[model samples]
Target chain A: MSVSTVRPDVYAQVQHFYARQMQALDAGRFADYANTFTEDGTFQHSPGAQPAVGRAGIVAELERFHERFADDPVQRRHWFNHVALEPLPDGSLSSTVYALIVTVRPGGTPKIGPSCVVHDVLEITEEGVLTRSRLVTHDQEAA
Target chain B: MSVSTVRPDVYAQVQHFYARQMQALDAGRFADYANTFTEDGTFQHSPGAQPAVGRAGIVAELERFHERFADDPVQRRHWFNHVALEPLPDGSLSSTVYALIVTVRPGGTPKIGPSCVVHDVLEITEEGVLTRSRLVTHDQEAA
Candidate 1:
């Protein structure tokens, strides 16, 4: 049973945060995307994989991931759904976000690429919301 | 630009409703799953595909889908994440739910199956919450 204690605005903010993060990644603004996390943020791309810790490390890892589309003018968009947020005992919040990545090849229709999900541990403070740790899991058959 | 006017309780209810629907399907309780929709509920398995209209039709379609594993006792579970809800202009709420289906072959570890997303138009009336229409889309390469 889930309680309705979380404010509606918080949900909206989280959604917006994800949207902006996706936009930044799509636009090749890795720095902007990395800035959404805390100074010591952690990003794990898959199970049993090492996480990219700290903003600099996250940016580096993301850049490496983007290398595939570097030469080509590929279009990328992330669609997130089934987002669930829960309060944590550490005065923070956790969110489970399911995502679908769509890629458009040159002069081709958009095709679904990967089905990914992120478990985000977020800290909300007066300074603003920050993602402390995010563990991402995706179908191994992602194209 | 989204506004946070929707009640938090609505989000909780939508999440719970989806959970129950998935549970019923996994348990092979087709009737219970069908009951989650309205009298004239519609379910679209893929974009531009013919939908199963009405509760009876939904039940029939779902039963047909389950026929593949009818001979064997297959384990099924659905994981839904990143659920986004927005208030629509027609007084119905819209939800974008990302779902991953996991299938466990007899005596094997669970493997991911189709990764799909459903955009559901929900009606919350005094009678109860109902799924008016659901549009599902998925990766063409999904197995």
Candidate 2:
């Protein structure tokens, strides 16, 4: 699998795609978040975890994840950096980024939650770039 | 003041420049970090703060800043996100990013320091992309 640097236009498109996707998820727009993915997209939270397959399944899993924080007043922000994009031979793009989960409550200092590395396979369609597969790995687990 | 999105190649170049620049600063390579800037590059930590002018001055100021934590065992990491790039009419690139300073002690969780927005004027010379001027604004102060 040869991975090469993506063109500038492709990089810009991917960045914008993530910006919208993360914002939707953080703002509790589960359906909108799922829309950023393909109909058959898969999301694996971690290794050995059952993957959330397909758009509907992804939304269901995200809702369950949000339920865990329903009673919490803390706001979570996803910060991504070191976004490295690679062009794959199969025409899909490979994007790897370091993701930081920052949580802050009203009148409190922000804290860093789990640090993760996310690997995403992206494909371009009539609607622009969308995720085809996503796998997140916790930093500690990787270490 | 017309700003437009940068070409894909420029974006990649800027990203790589930052990866090297930030690593040099965090690893205590003050001179190496300073070299990432143009000879007359300036760094202003916050609005109304006296800016460190030139590479020599920038290195000196950074050294002093590091001295304040010399006795501390905490490791500081600079994580930047939402890196937006624009092309300026003068052949300079304007880059803006949200920066988070994360500090962690041995065996302890990471805590976020001041959240800041950094605006940088970048120029590409024979040596690649270099910072011509940088201004950082604290989120709290902006609010």
Candidate 3:
């Protein structure tokens, strides 16, 4: 078995970046979330439909998502789990994050759901931020 | 912004581990998948029901999942995105991976689905294998 080359401090960075992502998402900070991606980033869903590519595209898509959710009076607590991050060569990182979402309606039962797999290839920005080259596979079964 | 402790070589190790994990999964080697977690590891879904803790429990849960699929006589290929491995102080790692699951029906069209998010905390075993401390989360919505 080969010795691990990964240093200990990367976890702190990733944890920090992810926490910000969650905070932005929960606070409906679409613009901020969009900025987490690289300049030429891409977000692809299913095989069909056009993918949201580049920083501008990500911003637009997040904005659209925020707008659509604006009408939903229910509050959702987005919980994530089963996450695995592997480092790639050339300064990029590929990671997988699984989510178990629970949507709560006021004075009603909360709806729980199965795994939503989010696979991404990320690059650490010069400013020490995590940006996406590609964010693939956002399970939308809950929607 | 703080400087990064995650160097390129470290990323390579993280990348290889995940590639091996997926390879084992696709080959129907469930035990290898289970072995990817630590002894006191926990796999949580929805924070309800008992977390699949320890190797035995994790194996049992995965067996159930594989059994259900095997009974259905389906052929599926769940593609995974790159792995992001964030190093922890103890030389362990926290990671996130994104996946796209496309299930092709028996002699039917392949149905594409949304991405799921998987969040995990893992530690490297004495043998150098990456093992999970916790595996949790789910899909956002319908595939």
Whose DockQ is greatest here?
2
- Sorting all predicted structures by DockQ, with the top scorer first, yields 2, 3, 1
Candidate 1 wrongly placed segments (more than 4 Å): A1-67, A70-143, B141-143
Model 2 per-residue lDDT tens digits across residues A107-140: 5666776989999999976557789999999987
- Candidate 2 vs candidate 3, TM-score winner: 2
Model 1 DockQ (Cα-based):
0.04
TM-score per model over all chains: 0.61, 0.62, 0.55
Q: State the fraction of real interface contacts model 3 keeps.
A: 0.02
Off by over 4 Å in 2: A1-13, A16-77, A81-108, A113-143, B1-5
Clashes of 1: 9
Model 1 residue B40 CA deviation in Å:
1.0
Candidate 1 per-residue lDDT over residues B47-136, each given as its tens digit:
877999999999999988988867988888987765666788989988776666788977898766465667899999886678999888
Better of 1 and 3 by TM-score: 1
Model 1's i-RMS, to one decimal, reads 7.4
Worst 10 residues of 1 chain B by lDDT: B1-10
Error of 2 at B96 (Å): 1.1
Clashing residue pairs in all predictions, respectively, total 9, 1, 63
- Candidate 1 — which pairs collide? A81-B81, A81-B82, A81-B83, A82-B81, A82-B82, A82-B83, A83-B82, A83-B83, A98-B82
